[model samples]
Target: MRVFATLLRRDLAMLLPGGRRGQSLLPFLFFLAIAMLYPFAVGPDADLLRRTGGGVIWVAALLASILPLDRLVAPDIEQGVFDQLAIRGIADEAAIAIRVLAHWLSFAPLLMVAALPASVLLNLDGSTLSIVVLGLLAGTPGLAAIGVTIAALTAGLRGGTALAGLLLVPLATPILIFGAGSLARPDDGGILLAAAISLVALAIAPFAGGAAIRAARDS
Candidate 1:
């Protein structure tokens, strides 16, 4: 229990904005940049902006989400943190699960909050804004898990950041579809589906990341 707490705290500190390595503003800024520039590029069509805004937000969120993956696992591995954790009898699975939680905490809430301003910028109405927020809440955890897993797998490779981003895009596509799709639909089914996918990703990430870390260690 103590070990888990310690690790979780450390991970949060490292990944949270203004922490040692957290690119908290970078992703947030990138997300805002997309939103800010979008209206200019497409011209002032209020109806068009409202209609397509949710999807644009989803795209921005997805791209911004990947920006931090490069630092996810590689830094810890380089600093021998994982090796030390293993030596102390901590399971890699447990470590990774904690990281997933930390990773999600670091950005998910901010992304949700950022959505409010984005909604204003994009001219999204109340109901559509609600759908966007709900969808992001349901999907961001899955995105975080995928980021961690990809980061772990590509920790020591050259161009690993680019590879991780490329790998993440495909895996995150379903979440994007379901999450953003809900904005266009009348029901909550898409959000439910996105939540289900998030649960699956959350369930699988620890094992997948653990295995990748083990492989990296052995190689």
Candidate 2:
């Protein structure tokens, strides 16, 4: 328990905004940039913006989430942090599980907060904004999970960073589909489905990530 807390704190420090890597806010800013540019790209069509804006926000969020995937586990692996944790009898699964939480904390909430400005930029109405927020809250965990898992899997590989981004797109597309789909349709089921997918990912990430780390450690 104490060890987990310590690891969690370390992760938070490194992963949080303005941390050592200096890339913490990249995704956040990237998300906003897309939102801001979208209005200009599409021209001054209020109805068009209102209709497609949610999907655009969703796409922006997906891309932003990928920005940090490369560093998600590679840095820790390179620094022998995982090796030390193993020596200390802290299982990789536990470490990855904590990392998942830290990962989600690192960007998910900030993205939700950023969505406020994004909504304004895209001119989303109250109901659409509500759906967007709800969908993001339920879906970002899965994004974090997929990111961590892919990071673990590719930590030691050549071009792992590029590979991680490529891998993230397909894995996270479902979340994007349902989350963004909710905005297009008048149904709340999409949000619910997105939440279910997130729960499943959260449940499976620790074990899958743990195995990947072990494989990487051995090979």
Candidate 3:
């Protein structure tokens, strides 16, 4: 437990905004930029923006999640951080699980809060805004899992960063669908489904990332 806490703190220090590696802000800013700019791109159509805003926010969140992918696992692998952990009896899976939690913390909460102003910008009603915040809360964990897994898998390949971005979109579609789809019909259990999907993704990510790390270590 202490080891996990230690790792979590380390990962947060690396991944958090203005951390040593200087991440966190890109995704936050990117998410905000999308919300800020969407109105202009579509012109002053309040009704249309309100109607479509939830989905746009979902898409923006997913895309913004991608911005930090390359930094998630690659830096550790490169610096032999995982190797040091291995020496101390930490399994790659356990390490990855910690990272997944840290990764979610890096940006999800801020985006949820940002969704407030975004809601106002898009003219979202109270109900829709509530649903959007709820969906993001339920779904961003899955996005975080997907991001870390991709980062681990593509850790050493050439052009891995771009590939990571490309791979995330398709893999994250289920979360996006159910999460954003909830806005259309909030009481239809879409949030529950999104949460379930996130749980599944979260379950899979640690093992997948562990194996990918093992592979990277061998090659």
Top of the candidates by TM-score: 1
User: Candidate 2 — worst ten consecutive residues by lDDT sum?
Assistant: 13-22
lDDT of 3 by residue, 1-219 (tens): 888888999999998899888967889889989998999999889899989988999999999999999889998999999999988999999999999999999989989988898888888899998999999999999999999999999999999999999999999999999999998883859999999999999999999999999999988
Predicted candidate 1 versus true structure: per-residue lDDT over 151-208, tens digit per residue: 9999999999999999999999999999999987889999999999999999999999
Per-model TM values vs. the true structure: 0.98, 0.97, 0.98
lDDT of each: 0.93, 0.91, 0.92
Poorly placed runs, candidate 1 (over 4 Å): none
Tens-place lDDT digits, model 2, residues 31-144 = 999999999999989889999999998999889988988778888889998889999899999999999999899999999999999999898999999999999999999999
Q: Residue 140's C-alpha lDDT in candidate 1?
A: 98
After aligning candidate 2 to the native by TM-score, how far in Å is the CA of 129 from where it should be?
0.5
Model 2 lDDT at residue 149 = 94
Give the Cα-based TM-score of candidate 3 against the true structure: 0.98
lDDT of 3: 0.92
Query: What TM-score would candidate 1 get against the native?
Result: 0.98
Candidate 1 displacement at residue 119 in angstroms: 0.6
Clashes of each: 0, 0, 0
